[model samples]
Target: MTTETMQADDYFYEFFDAVSNSTDISYVQKGDVLLCEKTEVNQFGARVLPTFYCINFILSLIGNGLVLCIIYKYEKLSTVTNIFLLNLVISDLLFAFSLPFWAVYHHSEWIFGSALCKLVGSLYSIGFNSSVLFLTLMTFDRYLAVVHAITATRSRKTMYAFASSAVIWFISILASVKDMVLFDVQPGNQSMMLCEMTGYHHNIMKKWQLIGHYQQFLLFFTVPLAMVLYCYIRISIRIMSTRMREKCRAVKLIFIIVLIFCVCWTPYNVVILLQAIEMSNGDQKQCSDTLDYALYMSRNFAYLYCCISPVFYTFLGKKFQTHFLKLLAKRIPCLNITIVTPTQSSKTTSFRTPNTVTEH
Candidate 1:
């Protein structure tokens, strides 16, 4: 064979071997010969993603932590909506806890070993699924409170809220089982270790990854998004018909919550869908390169949702804002701001804070 043919053959052999060991290989065609190319996605991720992850970690930690403390100190979890809020905060915190590890992993190798690889992978899976589920539940809770208030009164109890949260947690754990089983500390380019799926035949590994993509796209994104849209539509119709401007105002924050969720997650899931399609169709170098950049950027943007959620979910609430300011003033006596606690009247007693005045 000629020198060029021999070089192409060598490239094929190297590609085969790399595929057998790792799924991070891409192919580019050079002068009618397909050559395996190691993508610089990791290097790019190292430069960009670690900064984003670190910022998200700090903001999510402090934001969700303050939400938790405020809920525990000032708010009563006697209402169903409050219970769901508590669960959502917990989910965000759980997800936030995994970011520091991922930030470090992107910056360097997976030095935490196999056990932590599985644990952190599973934590991310569970946190993401649970966070989406809890948001959907909260949206539904608002729908009932606004559209079917009387009919939902008996069903929307704190006990039922706890039961629903338990079920969501169970499903989230089930979703993470696959990650726990497949993720490990695997060798990557230049002998670096990565926390990724391993321990299966190359073909089988690709199938499993594809399955995960579809599972997340369908179960976490498509289904929940549909439910949220339906609930909000019904809520809007009910409120408009009743001419309750206050009711519309009450749900404005909830609408913002759902909007933020959609804006943050939709791009990431769309990228995953495109990636699944690209994987099934074999390698397209340009497409693969584009996807790698899109995935990292969009995923980091989605991570910011956990941090922004606290502001819309709790801080904007009238009572929560008052309580938080009071706490702040107390912490810094130099501010000397006086916060008056509103008296509990019969009208206000019917609702839990002005945010969800429609809810009993």
Candidate 2:
């Protein structure tokens, strides 16, 4: 804090000096407050990392944004299932909003202030949690329709669907806000603080961090996964015994959505579970490079689900697909790439066709 200490610490200047001094490639390691060792490497690969991050961010942004724009543009796409799809798109779009800033953070220092940090980080958690929750809900809807045909239709009304979604999002918000509150920049470290839960209170941080991660697995992964498996198992049984072709369509959609959900989240959850096991086993050291890389890959690749979710809707849901084709026609005449609908929605009503059944 004193002038002497300030003069003694010159990491910023040293960093630039080392970068400028090396003709080919250089690296700097801070050994102490004033002593920094600079080595000229074959190549300084730090810049390439940020570039990759930026690329991923751009791709995810365009994908998620397009899904949202298309969903909102068309009227026929607005059904109950599409409503859920809309909510999912909104969450992904919001998450994409933070990716550019994250790309910047990956390359450089945290130029954004404390408030934006909190906002962005919280939004990230909220969006991911929301996505997971909705996937779970969608699976359950399928279970209800395919397994418990008569009950599903009467229970899944428009108002109740909206209410359920609202409640799920509110819970997600509550679950995610802790990450923002706990996050803090590592003292005296320039940039390079990635997203993780910080415990403000001694043991509190670790306890809460572990809880949040596992909670994600439980609510979003374990329970929902169980329900999905059960739904499909039962649906398969019914289909085989009863000889119903229409039954196949509902289960098919459900299966695709479930597969998509698992694909999107399995890697990320695996990484988290690994960390949890390590911590629980008393390995308090920094993560191994391989583990860190796995986590990074999981987080980065998870965004693919954003674009994928809507596409599945189009593929499985006849009503939304119907509207989507109409919009494509309109789009051609205008010579504009105007988007049509956000959802690939199903048109099945509460009432079932004589021998056929539809799931949520």
Candidate 3:
């Protein structure tokens, strides 16, 4: 293949990256002819994606930041689940912090240097991977708390929680090493510098890209999702058997978290899986445009997870609501916000016990 052919192939593989910098051009080949067809996708993306990313960034920042502040101010980090929730919020914030740069990149070009390019790419990888891992840990913690409440006490200590979180961070960093090593600022069409993997030939790049897609699909989504499903299923069974309203409510909140995670990420991963299959079978040109569009739409939709998590994880909790209202009242003394005492029904449904795993 000539240089032009290689560039076209590279652009196709660029979709494998979390933050792809490719513009909208579909390369179609005929006998002794190369056709470059321009689509509205790039223009559409430039107009829409930056604004969407900015909105997502602001919402995720405020939501996750509020959760962090509330956790620090009112909630104790003694519980294993609390530790996991704290780490999860931090991961979301880390992911959100890169959004403005991406918004700029999508709107224009990569003005940032190669170092920052790699850093942002790694942040994307690390934050996303760690969020899933921490969520899975939280689900398992709840599982142990609800299912084997007596036996799990020995293992659910704060020291163990910290150790587990440290290990998760280490794993997330290791998972992101590929982005750190490969991503760089490279010149694209019309002198636009793109932050993408640039040095490898088309075939080599495709191999690595496939590896990345599969790695993310398996490690980030598949395995963690499986664990979450199993934990939640067991928790549901335990709750059903015990008929404990408190456990049911606790499980319901965590279950919604897991459900939202799956809903947000599943479509993107499915698109990636289809793309991977197409690439592996040497059928990249078929449905290339369709997959490109699907990838963009689904990936943007997946970003909603970070923004939505704070609501389900913190604000929906009765305890968190009370704490937030109290904090608000303290901050604004003129506001007559009265803290309501727990009614009998509220007490019966309360999941905030020393032995239970509650959302904070």
- TM-score per candidate, chains pooled: 0.84, 0.71, 0.84
- Please tell me which model should have the higher lDDT, number 1 or number 3: 1
lDDT of 3 at 217: 91
Can you write out model 3's per-residue Cα lDDT over 303-322, one digit (the tens) per residue? 87756565455555577778
Provide the RMSD of all predictions against the true structure, rounded to 1 decimal.
6.4, 10.8, 7.3
Clashing residue pairs, backbone N/CA/C < 3 A, model 3:
none
RMSD, model 1, all Cα superposed?
6.4
Q: Residue 280's C-alpha lDDT in candidate 3? A: 89
What is the C-alpha local distance difference test score of candidate 2?
0.59
For candidate 2, lDDT tens digit of each residue in 1-360?
A: 000111122565466677786532222223344322211110122344455556655665665555555567754333456667667767766666676666676555556766777888888778777876776566566556666769877887778669878988998888877777876544333334444344243235557767877887787678766876776677667665665447667556546656766777789878888877775675634324455556666755576565345444444554444455666667677655544433323333422211123433
Q: Which ten residues in a row have the lowest lDDT in candidate 3?
A: 1-10
Clashes counted in candidate 2 amount to: 8
Q: Which regions in candidate 3 have their CA more than 4 angstroms from the true location?
A: 1-39, 245-255, 284-287, 333-335, 342-360
Arranged by TM-score with the best first, the candidates are 1, 3, 2
Each model's total of backbone clashes: 0, 8, 0
